[model samples]
Target: MLARVVEANERWERLAAQLREENAALRAENEWLRERDVRREAELERVSAELAVLQRLVFGRSSERVRPSSPAGEDDDGQDDQSGQGDGPGRRQPQKASPRGPGGRAGRRDYSHLPRVEVIWDFAGGGYCCPECSSPFEAFDDHAFEQVDWRVTVRVVVHRRRRYRRRCACAGPRTVTAPGPPKAVGKGRFSNGFIAMLLVERYVAGRSQNSLIAGLARQGAQISSSTLAGTCAAAGALLAPLEEAIVARNRDSWHLHADETSWHVFTPDDGDGPARWWLWVFIGADTTCFVMDPTRAGAVLARHAGIDTTTGQLRPAEDGGPRRLVISSDFYTVYASAGRKTDGLTNLYCWAHIRRYFVRAGDANPTQLAYWTRDWLDRIKALYAAHDELTDAWNASVAPAPGRAAVEAAARLDDAYTAWDTALEAIEVARQAQMKSPGLQQPAKKALATLDREWDGLAAHRDYPMISLDNNASERALRRPVVTRKNAYGSRTDAAARLAATIWTVTATAEQAGLNVLTYLTAYLDACGRNDGKPLTGPDLQRFLPWNASAADLHTWAQPPETG
Candidate 1:
């Protein structure tokens, strides 16, 4: 009986050990499954966020304004409009003012700048006879009306250069013919004015070469697309020096707005197949410059901004003095990298871009994160409002080497600065607090990370009051090129791309100066023609720059061209 008892106890011990081992294995498996589930959930959230962004891009409104929902029982009218007027019950809504000022009907357009053509109608008998009485009616006064006329005619100009024969038989040729009118191209059929028109229509107006060719054909001028393209190329080359001058002037500015867009160049493969080029714009106070580069790297920035990549320093100015510049741009790494490398180079990030991040985040999960996104957008909007107030105060202040008005304006500016500072601090504090929150979502966290990373740049605008909160200037400058790219699909070759950059620089800079694009281009191309179809340089080029241009020249260019 004792031996049987020992054997049973041993079997029981073995069964207990097996149960313990099985329990340990099950726990290990469960832990691994939990970890894998966590990873998959994270991946799913990320993908869902990406999908939401893509959907918003495709179907959402382009404006970034975020309208928050009203609280519990409030109606839509509970919120005041931009003018602080509400349409709530018992409140009289203000009527919209007439756009025509004091009258319901819109005023007629003034065509005084256009040339007038007089056409008189008279009786065939030179006098009108009254039907009731057999008497001739004599007119003492005439009733008149004005009608604007438009006519576009393309005609061949035959330059009949007179020839003089040497009657005395001097030691020269028998006949001496006057030089033919300066041609924009060597032996090309198109005149300088024609080339200028083509450029204005194609580049400034964003018309495609094919469309221009067809238009010319309709006007009884049969010109091939290639020929038109060649004419544009020649004009671009002639204007290349002016483009360089504009670039130099742009780089010389203390504050600048910079932006770039993708451009396709088909030929002269840049090692990579079907090379993707870039068209960059840097707009100064008075000048806008465009540069075509194969790469969108820091080197391009360095080259254009006069930064020496090797030393990470700005090249000396013409007077051999240190140069300083503040660039307003999006949060592109290249701008930041360039800023870091060069001394005295500051990068002021775009608030609009930072707002876009939070905007996207809010869009990803609107129901859950809408309030959070609204808070951030409101904070950014406050910054803009504060800046505007500051600008208004400064503008209203009188000058004359700083007087009492300036002192008063400075005080007002201080108050405005306080508001701006409060708004900025609110953002920073919220960013910090929410970044540490345990319940934060991935989208919000990502937006916070961008804000945190770009905090220094976004706040850099405080030091430079002249700079804008957004890089909208550069973005606006790029729109013309983008439109042209859409129409013409970019240049065909590397040289063509460079030429495009040159022409775009000229046209865009001229428009910014409020100069008539056609008249300005015509004058420049005519000057080029007189220079033997070569580009103007040195002092001559300076005269064409918008800021340095002569008043007479500017006045002439500003006026509307007369029609024949």
Candidate 2:
């Protein structure tokens, strides 16, 4: 409490000093007669507008969520994916302040541990007396209310490891005592729990290093910000094997969702290159891997997915066998190039992204758009509806074991695919008829060009129903890191950026596999400590991998998700 108060006072003093300087400058501005009042006002307005834009760029909401004129159906059970949020305590706290109203407000809480504090209200002489009559009065009944008694307390724990020698033991009277607990950072005073908490608070909770320093100082730790940063970097380096495991696991998957977001780092891949770093997210069915690079080039995707960008070739999986891979991504040029460069690779473009362009086009030129945009939306909707029906049929018909019904479901899917083709053909015919003259406005025309460009990739999913219609899975995986990026304004150096990629890979992959990040980190760090900071490999490491991990092992190391 004292630390917070002092810090707040210091900030106020600094602001006051700034304001004082500004006031002095204003007082000395009598030379303003040099400019016309109207022009000066106009200049002030322009500066104010620019400042507002800057403020928005720096501090506005970071959600780039596209809400079309007609809302798209949810890809999940209507549950929006949150960066660090989960079902209970020890979960990731939401990075942003909750907006107003019922959705923002949480349900009734059960923080039952009320600290006892009392304030007694009584009349003169500590008695219930009538003040005007100066006479004692009997209290009829007691009224009570409850309120939170919140305060801050800070302390440091001193771990005292006692050493003792066996005084009369036959085993040479060797010195022995209980082992001291492991630390995430070697030779660090902080415990593993403290380090884990700091990590969660920083990355998952989206708190900056300076914010962490202030918070610890409030707890009387008085630690420097550099110490926390160094600890985090050390922890990332220590648990790098787990990150590699995630990437290796991704390599083994047949289908993956790939996406990337802008990041900033001082010493990027090329020192002379712009710090326009890209954070790539490749999420397999069971694993999520985050990698940072200096370019948005297809080469990063190629390198990580174990493919040769020059030729459409995949190197082999861990089993030394080539994979028949399918990649789903947004309409980025790099994704297309990467897909084309790989053999037997099916590229599925996001349908939602396709729809978003048309939606924007319709918004820009609503009158002309009504001629064919509505037709396009209807056809798209019909296609999705058929897909949903087929998906349901497949789930209902396909049995646990190979059977006649499984064959029947495959036939039914094939029939649905044919039917979808027929529907698309009808739309194409209508489009060809209108292509002669008086076609679409520039907005709609541009949108049609995109559809034409991506049709092959968008329809590639017809051969594979297992792929999603959208690249939402990968986008959702990047949300937490994106929020942290917004908060920290990105990393300071290449090493830090690389460290973040490694750490976030393990954490996000564990989250995808429904594993508790804290427990996973602790176990991983303990393993590294036991191995003298060596990376895990072979059978010893395979068991720790999420895909190979046993149910009991996951439960022991991290909480398994609740199932219906």
Candidate 3:
């Protein structure tokens, strides 16, 4: 009995110790779960914030501007809302629509320049003699109102070049014939006007190939897609030399804008892997060039900027002076990398991009977002407004000595820069304070970090007045390509990609030169035809280049003279 009691007590004690160990383990696991739950909740909040920003990107206001007004609860222009406004935060006053001004009488549009063809209408006097009054009615004061109309004309024009045989009696049967006029394409059934219409319809108007063919079919042309594509591809060959000249103008320009977008191209002929290309555009004072590359690497930009791609260094001109360029672009690393590798290039950032980041950050934060956005927006307005004032002041103020005018301008610019720096200092103080606050959101923090990282680029324009503070020019220039991309999906085959770039180069540069796109293309094609399909030589090429062409040429090309 004693042995049994002792064994039973030992078993009971062992069981008690095991139960305590199990309880401790369970408590540890419960504590771990509590910690994980807290971390996961924090992560979920961050994700939710990001989702809100993305949603705003899809559906929010398109413009990044906030239109600076007075601070919340304060009246605009130093006026009280209620004549006794409260000190605490309050709602913004609703905007009122301005009254419309009296509209003047509408005037008729003049189209007298168009040729007129009058058709005479005659009636039989004998039929009118006996109907009602037994008196002949005479046509008096024929009514006429011009109606403008256009028609789809399908007519075959025959060119009969006169041939001459030897008139001498001793002639051995020799013949001479006058040559026919140049065609846009070699021996094609299409006229210069017809081919030009295709270029304008597809590229300038952003019409897809399928829609273009259907429209032409309705107009009685009934062109096949393969034919159109092949013609466009052929034109690319002729345009290659011209495109190189435009590219040269782009690189040589002191101030330029650079941008890039995705361009798709199928590679069935090349046996390439897939069809994704990058269409890079560079716009200058008198040139716009587009290039299609399979990669968006810094090397692609280096070549255009005259930077050494292999060593990532500047390739100075023979005179040992680097090219002077102030290039504006977004925060893409490639732009920055290219600018850094080249000594001549000074890359600047667009204020619009900076505003975009702040806008997105502000959208993601619901509470206190309005106050923050309004504050930053007001600062941005001040920045631009100050720059404008500086520009006006420089233009209006002249130094006593004409030789010292540039020096005086620089002095005024420096003063303005100093004043702007003061404003930025205040903004920085506010930013640093907000960053330290517990309520600051992640997006806002990220935006602040970006501004800090790109501060040098953002401040570039203040130092150099020639450089524009906004990349709006480049963005506007990019609109055409983006529209075509959306409509056509992208180019097909390597040839098509090259063709698209070539045509856009001509179209865009011609627009800059103020030449009508259709007329210019027709003239250029004619010039190519005259060159016997060979690449245009020095003077031959100069005649077609927008920069070199005379203003009279542009005006004539803008609208060809018509005779009745």
Q: Highest TM-score among the candidates is held by which one? A: 1
Q: Give each model's whole-structure lDDT.
A: 0.74, 0.66, 0.68
RMSD of each: 15.2, 24.8, 15.8
lDDT of 3: 0.68
The local distance difference test score of model 2 is: 0.66
Per residue, candidate 2 scores C-alpha lDDT tens digits across 459-513 of 7866666566788898888888888876666777888888888878878877777
Q: Per-residue lDDT tens digits of candidate 3, residues 1-564? A: 999999999999999999999999999999999999999987886787788667655545454433422334332222121222211112222322223335522322233333444533333322123233344333233333332222244323344444444433442334444445565466455555556667777888877777766665454443456667777766767778888889887887777789998887755355663467899888898998888888888877878877776777666765887657778999999988777766667888988888877766666664556577677767877777777766655564544346677677667767876777776677677767877788676777887888878878887776665456788887887788777776676776777777888888888998888778877877877788777755677988998888788888878887842322
Best by lDDT: 1
Candidate 2's C-alpha runs over 4 A off are 1-155, 158-171, 267-274, 309-312, 316-322, 370-372, 395-415, 437-439, 530-540, 560-564
lDDT of 1 at 434: 97
Residue-level lDDT of model 1, residues 1-564, one tens digit each, is 999999999999999999999989999999999999999999999999999778656655443443533223221212222222212212222322323324233433233333444544455545454444434443444444432222365654444443444444235444444444555565466666677777777877777666665665565444455556777777777887888788878888888889999988766556543468999999888999898998899888888888887898999988998889899999899999988888889999999888888877876667778788778888988989887876666566535236676777778878877887888888889989999999988999999999999999999887766567898889878887777777767766788788878888888889888888878877776777777878888777888998998899999888666554
Which candidate do you rate higher for TM-score, 2 or 3?
3
Candidate 3 ranges with C-alpha deviation above 4 Å? 1-27, 65-156, 160-179, 268-273, 392-415, 560-564
